[model samples]
Target: MIEISGKKILVTGGDGFIGSHLVEQLVDAGAIVTALSQYNSFNNWGWLEHTACLEKINIVSGDIRDPHFCRVITKDQDIIFHLAALIAIPYSYIAPQSYVETNITGTLNICQAALENGCDRIIHTSTSEVYGSAQYVPIDEKHPLQPQSPYSASKIGADAIAMSYYNSFGLPLTIVRPFNTYGPRQSARAVIPTIITQIASGRKQIDLGDTSPTRDFTYVSDTCNGFTRIAQSLNTIGKTINLGSNFEISVHDVFHLVAKLMQADVELFTDPVRIRPVRSEVVRLWSNNSLVKSLTGFEPVVSFEEGLQQTIDWFLQPHQLTRYKPGIYNV
Candidate 1:
């Protein structure tokens, strides 16, 4: 097992929801961390700007699509957590090419850079969406890959690119596929945030897409813990593992639960604009996380209700709540 403390670590997409949280955990673990936020003219670092440990680590603004930039940032890093990807399923419908560029080619850039730099470990993020609607319940790592949407297809391609690096070049790489991870700082594009934000914004009617689909929701911290644990274990190298709570809940159920926890008397309605294309929708996702548990002895500690309540508490904060425009259907 590798010690994270005092190691030079680089987190691509550290400015995002999961990436920001992982950055905090890495800092707390004593790693000398460098976080990469997508280059923007405004110099905004996304959610990382609000992180408590923001000042503790180095923040570089650049696009992972640029191989030179990825190479520059990856140099001298002991571990690379590649979380940067174009992940919104809805957006992928409108811009499939962007997903390919960022998710597929961007992953190529990171893996190539990591290989050349000789990084000790590379943790590539994957999503359950790659498993599509799940031909079987409790989907295991061996579950067949079904690209239901351009987003999932790009992720599938990205996962393959990362794994190929391991297979062909012997790069120390692990694919950590996480189920639906939601919590504070999640974008309103996601269901949980959409529900909580709309209700918190005082809307009586909440808008959502299909509610019948079920997902295995792992809290943000648990997912981050899985990433860190997988990175530490040499046994996990070249392996693809699922990080999930091993519990599944429907979107409708999640909406009602969040409404109850937030003490909001709200009704949910299907917004036409929010629904995915019929064939592109992934109707079910339940994860079998035995591999991660057996390898790292890590199990998600947060209960669904408990995690929802905590998320609600965070969103209720005026400073945080104001950041969201709940009335708009975030595509």
Candidate 2:
């Protein structure tokens, strides 16, 4: 393992769900962490605001869409983790321009900043959504990309831009493509949180979209470890690696699982507004994590049921559970 004892690192979306967990882990690894929280009037730092590592991190509030801010934040950093982007699929359909500006252009800004500053490495994040629906089981790194929605298209564009930097200019970088990650601090926008919150709120009926789409879910800590492990290895530079649990479960089954965990008898009510467009919906996503394992010796440590129980425990906390309106559809 490459030692991160005193290295300075920048995380673009450090205040987000997965990013917050990664920041905590990096701090525990003894890195001098700098986190960028999207600028807001109320000075809200998202999930990072409540963390014990808040004081240990150098927090910068800025927009990644702004090239100047990107350059400023990336300067003198040993490494950068570019996790900032617009990710909601339904919102992407209504505001593709926003997605393009943030996901694609924001990545370009970060890459250019990295090049100018001579950063040692960059861990660029990617999503399995780029694969659309899985054409084959255990989708590997070589699986063809199919952008079924504007959100996935923007991610593909961002990945292409980041890879181009590595190919054309020799910018040291790794694209960490994490399949659906779920854990504590996840917002209501995600299915797991949505289900847990509704059931915990004593809702007999739950609102959800299509029930058949399956996804390979990785725990948040495992996904964060994937980022750090890839960044530590020079072999991962200029390559895209997948981080996943290497298994699959349908949304319907997930609902039953959550309901069982909560001991709540809830019925899933299909919400028309919750479903994606027919062609835009990704029916299945299964990850083949051979490349990540071979390259970094990283494997998911949490089981599906264990991770689900942990997530449910977090949401069951009074303050956390009261933060959302479980009666309403998030998107």
Candidate 3:
């Protein structure tokens, strides 16, 4: 692997929660970073609006679903971090076709463009949700892919698309599958933000979906590090790696932790509208990230309590808190 200091890097979905943080890290590491912000008439840069390194990056506004746009942004880049997708689970149920077009077709565009442009490496992002409920604790790369929702199904297809390019065309590629990531700038659509935003809004009764499900949460910074670490390792090429803290916590416990940290007395209320269909809900997920450890010596350094406190502090900020509508279910 070459030095990232002067390398050209393109980050699709660069304005999203994890993508924004990753782009900042790339810039800080001295890489020439180009960020893809979804085109909007307002020209807002999503989460990148609050990024300190905004002036240091080249921001392009375009949809990933556009192959011509993907090809245009993908050219003259040493590396591409493909993270664009329709990620909300509930939204996936309502509009799976959109997920397929964005996640699956978008990945196809990126991979094809990377191959044509001679990009050295493509770091494709994956989610732990691809494994659905834990058939076994600490899910590994070899674990069965149980697409419990359209979102996961779309991701599964995307991962396959990326890997196929590597297998057939020998395009350098690696899939970095990070578990549930939470931190500052994460949209209210995610559960962690939902919980934090609701509590911060002075809601006496927290509205949540299924509380029984557990997830492996990784801090955004740690996940970004995982991507960079994986990208730099040649051995990770043409492979799928998982990024996660081995620890797991239930959604109810998450609410409890946040409420305790906020010093707010709140009762949890289950909202029927928020719940997923019986078969769609992933009951549990704990990642076996030993593969990434062996390959890149990467492990999640942030503890759950510490990360949650940091996230809560971020959402509690006046400017940040105002962006979220805590009174409504974001999904």
Residue pairs that clash (backbone atoms under 3 angstroms), model 1: none
For model 1, the stretches where C-alpha displacement exceeds 4 angstroms are none
What lDDT score belongs to each candidate, Candidate 1 first? Answer: 0.94, 0.93, 0.92
Positional deviation of residue 195's Cα in model 2 after best superposition, in angstroms: 0.4
31-148: candidate 2 lDDT, tens digit per residue: 9999999999999999999999988999999999999999999999999999999888888988999999999999999999999999999999999999989889899989999989
lDDT of 1 by residue, 209-275 (tens): 8999999999999999989999999999999999998898999999888888888888888988888
Q: Give candidates' CA RMSD values in order.
A: 0.7, 0.7, 0.8
Cα lDDT tens digits for candidate 3, 49-167: 88999899999999988888888999999999999888999999989999999999999999998999999999999899999999988899999999899999999999999899999
Pairs of residues at least 3 apart in sequence or in different chains that clash in candidate 2: none
Worst 10 residues of 1 by lDDT: 259-268
Q: TM-score for candidate 3, please give it.
A: 0.99
Residue 88, candidate 1: alpha-carbon lDDT: 86
